[model samples]
Target: MKVIVFDTKPYDRKYLDKENERYGFEIKYIEGKLTPDTAKLAAGYDVVCAFVNDDIGAATIDVLVDVGVRAIAMRCAGYNNVDIRHAFGKIHVVRVPKYSPFAVAEHAIALLMTLNRRIHRAYLRTRDGNFNLNGLLGFDMHGKIVGVVGTGQIGRCFIDICRGFGMQVLAYDPYPNPNAGIEYVSIDELLSRSDVVSLHCPLTAETHHLIDAKRLSLMKPNAVIVNTSRGALIDSAALIEALKDGAIGGAALDVYEEEAQYFFEDHSNDVIKDDQLTRLLSFNNVLVTSHQAFFTHEALEKIAEVTFENIANLSAFRGNRETYLANEVCYQCEKFGGDCPKKNHKNCF
Candidate 1:
């Protein structure tokens, strides 16, 4: 199978090429994102592999279909960028759902620790030969309440880490996990009570701006929020207002809502035009990291393996006319339940 990967970085190429040795698939790497304009480059390829921030929207999907691309293999877990509704019966879509939950969970804890202890600030201070300890006081994590917003693999791992710190754990999920071994509360209660709130949910229409002004108002005055999940989960403007008013404590973010344009690229020489992002960086309490929570070596290797597995599965399905591909996701199945109305179909296509 021939695959063209978009938004390729050196690390991406390195790991993907190493993994491709097993699959023996012809692969092409493109540094540019897979936008509608770039979709034509997938012509004659069996599959187009994209990353988290790539534009796999309706127009791009149409172009891929027109250019004889049969499948979209997302190297990352999130597929919110893909227009699944438009791609139904047109092309198959697959993704790497879980690629090192510990990588993201550990990164979330690192952000929380860095923000709480002001380690970033202290590092700069020490480097500048200032040894003042004033304004550097941080509370103990022990005996504090932590609200975990999602109890998926990553969220569960975070909860375990918080428990190891002797912190009380309160979780909120629409579908609570029975095996989570933690208290499940309403989102409002979690916000009002927790000293630290961590988000680990997917971005959906329902979850977009889940942490708006109203929600922020419910949080404890000294509560700190951490997000290693989708960017749009928290409203950046509302967060800024909350920070200005000191409504909550602070935020440690690994993703931004409008990060597609700036996250993966070097922009130190360029003027960052995103005013909200600029304002976010202006706050001393807020710590912003490029969307790299899932950038560990293990995670990248698994992503590459799963991505290639998805392509190989699609190739096998196409040849043998199988009923289903394990990692396949479609609008009908996602919008409804997991049950697709198209019975015994090889895929949505």
Candidate 2:
């Protein structure tokens, strides 16, 4: 199949090309995202491969369908950017759901350690020969309580990391795993008692802005916030207010709500237009990284492998079998109709 992979970085090409040697698909990688204006680039391709930041809305879906694109493969787990309501019964959508959960979980731990130890600041001071440790005071993590929201694969891995530090774990998930050996509490209780809060949930109507002003207020005054999940999981404007008033000690974010416009690209010559992000950057306690939590070699290889497999499976079956595509959604039945096929719940049409 001819695939046009959009929003591709150099690393994506390096790994995808290495993996494509096995599948032997004609892959055309584009540096820009999959927006309405850029959708024409995939006019003759069989599959449109997108990344986390791609704008695969209703308009883009229409263009893809009109241009003979059969499958929409997301290289990442999250599908918040896609318009599932409109794409139902039209173009098939598939994703890499569980690719290297440890990559993201370990990154959450890295962010917390860097923020607490003032490692970023220390690196700058030492480079300038100012060797100062006056403001680098950090508390011990041995007895700290960590609140982990969403106890999925990545969240479980994060809990293990926290437990390794001798920290108590408090988790919140609609579907709790009793064998995970963590105290499952309500969101309110977890926020109030934790020294650090990490989010690993998906972006849905209920979870959008899950960490808002009310939740931030319920947290400890000196608690830290680390988010490697969806960007809209926390309200950015409200978070800025919390940071300004010292309601929270610090924040280390791997994603931002408005990051689609700026995350994967370089804008060094241009003035930043987003005031909220600008203010967040000015804070000494805030650390922001590009959405690179899942950029590890193992994670990328898995993403490429699964994404291609999804494309190939959809192309081969072209029928009613949906188990091949992991967690495929029948948006037609899920959103509009009440009756979904029991056998192939993943892709009921």
The C-alpha lDDT values of all candidates are: 0.92, 0.89
- Candidate 2 error regions (>4 Å): 319-324, 332-341
Return the top candidate by lDDT.
1
Instruction: Give the per-residue lDDT of model 1 (tens digit) for 1-349.
Output: 9999999999999999999999999999999999999999999999999988999999999999999999999988888898989998888899999999999999999999999999999999999999998877788999999999999999999999999999999999998988767899999999999999999999988999999999999998889999999999999999999999999999999999999989989999999999999999999989999998998999999998998889888888775655578788778777766666766445446
Query: Which one wins on TM-score?
Result: 1
What's the C-alpha lDDT at position 64 in model 2? 95
Error of 2 at 221 (Å): 0.7
Alpha-carbon shift of residue 201 in model 2 (angstroms):
0.4
Looking at candidate 2, the ten consecutive residues that score lowest on lDDT are 336-345
Per-model TM-score on C-alpha atoms:
0.97, 0.95
